[model samples]
Target: MEENQELEQELAMEDVLKNYDFKKIHTGEIIKGSVLKVTNDEVIVNINYFSDGIINKDELSFESDVNPFDVVKEGDEISVKIISTDDGEGNVVLSKKQADEASIWDSVDDAKKEGKTVVVKVKSETKGGLIASYKGLRVFIPGSQAAARRIELNTLVGQELEVKLTECDKVKKNIVASRRVIEEAEIEAKKNELWSGLTVGEKREGKVTRLAKFGAFVDIGGVEGLVHVSDLSWKRVNNPEEVVSVGDTVNVFIQSVDREKNRLSLALKDVATNPWTLVESKMKTGDVVEGKVLKFTTFGAFVEVADGVEGLVHLSEISDENIAKPSEVLEIGQTVKVKVLSIDAANHKMSLSIKDAVEKSKEYLQYTDNEEESTLGDLLKDKLSGVKFE
Candidate 1:
């Protein structure tokens, strides 16, 4: 009986010592546990410690609508990070998501060093880019770093992508990723494959990707070609949008290709007929042509006399009187009758005059050449004879 009693005392003492030893473990330590009970606000976990640990609903997932039953259930083993000791109510604070995040940071650090690609699912949309989930951790991708080709970040929600870990801060819990590097690498590979057969003056079909003031961007296969606005059409174009818009599939003639600089000069006008080639045969000097007012500057107004044929009506010849601006007398898109005073097909210049035409028509009917010369001399002598210098 005495020996049995001693054995029982030793077993009880061992149990007490085990409980004390469990209590010595601290908060922030990762431990394995089993789900004991689940509630709307918190979940009870049996961590094999002195007391059952309590995991708040917020710690279940970074997602806001997470339900305890969806994440943890009765008798399911999970890993949790201790947040605090028992709150004196026999409840120890623990977190599941935080522990997972800690592990994710470790993996992210390793992946960054190895330059490894990681698969991440976009969790939410942000102003700069998309918020993504990688092993329960929030990762940020800046807008500029999102892709080689621009993408709608909002549409990427719930979409999975392969990204490279570019930056990581375990202290601030900030992780930054880059899809641009991967995208750029792929684009370069595609360009190399396409460039092998591409040469200057080659023809290619491409989609217009972007329109700018100076030019339009064309996606020729995976490479980009620049078709300057001047090269868009044989006719004058004020804006690239007037000739082509985004997503326009167009056939472009490659004018020049610089492989070293990765530059391509494209021309949409080259594929079309040049209007200037027939200008001398179709148009003549002294012809009264109706033209549209294209643009006005301080020097003159450019008028489209014919298709791809433009003439400048100098500010001096626009009206009999000196006008401050052409806009005052002429408006955009207005048709006007102009006499072609001179046409230089070589230089692409046509001198146009509105007042000279009227004057010439009046002189042709009323004045003789001898009579006009005598009268012009008499008027000049009368106007200048009285002017004397001291």
Candidate 2:
């Protein structure tokens, strides 16, 4: 019985000694505890010390305004730093906020060294950067690093973004992050996926992002493709902007692609009717047609009779009277009537004659004294009979 009583007394003394072991604690030491009681402004934690430790609500987190109950509840386990072993009342003064800050700063250092990513929540905007939080530690993200493009700052508030630590100063408490770090990688991955699946002749829907004299750029998800000026429409296009404006949703067909160079040749006209075929179906040789002069060269004038269809009028065919050059009789954008002298629609070629058309009018006038008008066939025969082969 005496041995049993001594064993019980030893066990009780061990338990009592364990409860009053706060003397072993050092200032600024981090220790684990469980919440014993929670109040409006303080959380009573059992650090298994001499007395229950108190953590003020203000020290619950770095945030200026915090509620103790919101952060901890009875029986919840948390790590706290011993701000003081005894506050003169034999009680430990603990700080959960300081512990968290120290731990996060260490993490920030590791992230910078290892090039790791961390999540940040935007809290507000400052003059040159956005005020953000990483596990309650303040971080500054410059405006330029917030995104690949300029973005509205107000919309970013309360938003969470993954970022890379670019600058960290433990003494100054200055930490900087860049959201663009992750964004650039995401953009590249998206582009790679799009390039891998893209095929020639595939039709894609996109929005016109910008226009240049040479082409228009379109965003069809992660990649941008160029629609060259000549491919904007079946008709002649002097400027890409003339055919498609910025922000216009356009349907285009991929004409060709170069994965190595990350380039795409696109055409808006391939899906539409071939204008050359339309010209063939509507016009025949000796048929008079109205056209507008498109350009001039030393030898002839090129005129457009229909969309995407042009015919060349040689110097000899410009008029019966001799002319030094086609410019003497025709100017760009000048509307004139010409006879379709020959057409090879399959090859998209056509020859026009202004002098022959005038001669045909004269033939009608002279022959009209007896008959109405000679058939185009009879007119052709007369013209061919007069030709002398060299």
Candidate with top TM-score is: 2
Model 2: lDDT to the true structure? 0.88
Candidate whose lDDT is highest: 2
- Across 279-390, the per-residue lDDT of candidate 2 in tens digits comes to 7679999898889998888889988999788999998999888899988877899998889989988877899998888888788778885453457667778889968889
Write one digit per residue (lDDT tens) for candidate 1, span 1-390. Answer: 999999999999898777555655697899888999999989999887768899999998877878888987899999899998777797889999888777778889999999999999988888888899887788998888888877888877888989998888888888899889998998888889987878776688999999889999999998898999888987898899888989999999988888899898999887447777777898788887789999899988999988878999999988898799899899999998888988888777888986776677667656687688999999999999879878
Which residue ranges in model 2 land beyond 4 Å of their true spot? 1-11, 18-24, 110-114, 284-288, 331-335, 370-390
Q: List the residue pairs that clash in candidate 1.
A: none
Candidates in order, TM-scores: namely 0.52, 0.83
Error of 2 at 103 (Å): 3.0
- What is each predicted model's overall lDDT from 0 to 1? 0.86, 0.88
Clashes of 1: 0
